[model samples]
Target: MKTILLPLLIGLMLVGCSSSPSLSNSSSLYQELNGQSGLERLVDAFIQEIAGDEQIFHYFAKSNVDRFREGFITHLCDVSDGPCEYQGDNMIDIHTGMKINEADFNRVVELLINAMEAEGIPYRTQNKLLARLAPLRPEIIHR
Candidate 1:
């Protein structure tokens, strides 16, 4: 009876493991976002929306606009488990001397949320992306 019970338990555990989600592969999420092509669309839409917003866009305009835009997309893609490498400066050094206050950061976040919404990214996905990006706040924020 003990031997029979142990085998049953192992089989159940194996079944459970097979049903669990793969933590490392974000391919499913990428597919939900419409894959690589969708990434391109989302990046383009996000940049356009942010650029049109005067408050945040001005700050961006003063900085390296092209590099900033490209870096943002690269970071997003890398975090989302896409096949892209982020080759930008460290967040802390990049944001240094910018004198970005909390209010400015919040405003940029709002614009980013809007852009994500415009792209029809679901709340769950947005939250997942935000969770990944949140840690960079300390490095990106100054003043």
Candidate 2:
């Protein structure tokens, strides 16, 4: 039993390692998002989706759309193994007075998902980005 289990575990580990992306290639694939250029387009799609939503547009009426958009792009790029640094307020502080609730956050996430789909980003890439951003839920959702 011990011998069989050991071989099985080793085989699993080899499979996992083989399927994983190399750090350098991952970084290069991230850079393919056109660095700032690709990020800019992604941000535009996400913002347009958000702005079109009647349920959420009011919340951003007075907000700096361009700045928020760029910040989001930077954050996404940085988290996706891209060569960029995000230098904005932390997630919690940024949404302090905005009173964003779970529903609102979810709506924004959905919009982001749609935007990613519209850009033809594969599901794996989308999931990778989402996984990185998921931890910010607690900080961004005020309610």
Best by TM-score: 2
Candidate 1 lDDT score at position 23: 49
How many clashes does the backbone of model 1 have?
0
Candidate 2: tens digits of C-alpha lDDT, residues 17-79: 988998545565466555677777878998999789997899889989878877888888777
For model 2, the superposed segments whose C-alpha errors exceed 4 Å read 1-29, 32-34
C-alpha RMSD by candidate, in order:
4.2, 5.8
- Each model's C-alpha lDDT? 0.77, 0.81
Q: In model 1, what lDDT does residue 119 have?
A: 89
- Residue 37, model 1: Cα distance from true site in angstroms: 2.3
